[model samples]
Target: MMPIDRERSDADMNSLKRTKLAYSILSIVLIVIGIYLIIRPQTAMLTVCRVLGVVLMFYGIIRLLGYFSHDMYQLAFQFDLAMGIFSLVAGCIFLFRTEWIAELIPAFIGVIVLIDAVFKIQTSLDAKRFGISKWWLILILAVIAGALGAMLLVIPLKVVEFVMVLIGINLVIDGVLNFWVVHDTVRMIDSL
Candidate 1:
């Protein structure tokens, strides 16, 4: 390879490593937050919203970075650009307009999760075609997460505790599924 190409390749590899690390951190955070919500459904809504806002923003930035990372397969982050932008916008609204968006938070989050699940479904299919063995797991998790997200959309805001628990379940599933997809599908190998 030319010197310039080698340098670029090195940079891409570094970016990919960082993106993978970010995804790992994000996944753990999601799982922890999900457990917290599950354990304390009665926690103040404002607190939950603030925390979620920060998490969503972080997730958005990570997804954007992942989208640009030079993974060999390019399957994991194909839909991340759009998802990242949507997450950033939602995070901003949740953070800046907390009071106004409080009651609608569940539905908004539901939309995000649903969209992610849909994209993961496509990713899983692509992975299957690419001969990945764990594709079925991704598809199953995405389906379950999608169902939970849809439930969040239709849930009456009157049932605050139930909504919180449901959201927690969805988050846990999404986190695990995303972690798996990123770990399994994103490859940095220069030679196929």
Candidate 2:
């Protein structure tokens, strides 16, 4: 009984609805993680920083060995040699002075996150200029982001662990939401 144009419009609405739901779920997860990081940053900071250092050291060592060895893989060897040595040095630094280095981790991450949020808010505002309905959402998000940034800059050592935990939570949430989209889309297509 429905007109062809009405059917098309309905289909478009369904698609948009699905997309928005998925995005909202992912955003909620990320916000939860951000909250966690705000609460418990020190432990997260140390663990992440140490792991990163070790990985770097491993790559550096491989690079250095490859250059001196007979394998001569050329590009890979050179890359490995450089990375291996640098990683080893970095790993040592992290291993020995985790306490000192960990303090910087939270602040560094906060700055990066704050910058990213600002960019996102700018984009959201731009969208609003095109007559989008959620201009207030961007303002709220920006305020939260700015507050978190200030916290990080003021308290690095105390914040790293919390930040790490929060970031981990966000990633897991994002991954789950993305996986859910694949599920919902499959279900929708099956129904059709």
Candidate 3:
């Protein structure tokens, strides 16, 4: 390969690594938040909103970065650009209008998760085409997450605590699914 090409490849690899790391961090954060919600469903609404706002903003930035990174398969980050913008806007609303947003947070987050789950279903199919052995697992998890997200959307606001628990469960599952997909499918050139 030409020297310039090699340099570009190296830069791309570095960016990919950073993107993966950022994604991993975001996944971990989701798991932690999920656990928190599960354990303390009765926590103050404003505090929960603030925490979710920060997390959503962070996830948005990470998703944007991941979209720009050079993933070998290109499946993992395909929907990131749009999702990032959506997340950023949602985060802003949550932060600036916590009181107004508290009631709607579940539905908003449900939409985000549902969208991600749908994209992940596509990613799993692409992974199958690429001959990844664990693609079915991704498909199953994505389906489950999608169901959970749909439930969140339809559940009445009167059942806030139950909704919180469901959201926590969904977040945990989604986080694990994302982390596994990124680690399993996102390959550095040297590993190829």
Alpha carbon lDDT of each predicted model: 0.90, 0.48, 0.90
Q: Quote the RMSD, in angstroms, for model 1.
A: 1.2
Q: Give me the runs in candidate 3 sitting further than 4 Å from their true place.
A: none
Angstrom error of the Cα, residue 170, model 3: value is: 1.3
Candidate 1 local lDDT, 15-98, one digit each (tens): 999999999999989988998889999988888898999999999999999999998888998998998898888888889999
Query: Worst ten-residue run, lDDT, model 1?
Result: 183-192
TM-score of 1: 0.97
Task: Count the clashes in each prediction.
Answer: 0, 27, 0
Q: What C-alpha lDDT does candidate 3 achieve relative to the native structure?
A: 0.90
Point to the candidate with the largest lDDT: 1
Model 2's TM-score against the true structure: 0.41
Q: Sort by TM-score, best first: what order?
A: 1, 3, 2
Give one digit per residue, the lDDT tens place, for model 2 in 48-127.
66664564454344335434442211221223344445547766777678878676655654554465456445545554
Q: Residue 96 lDDT in model 2?
A: 76
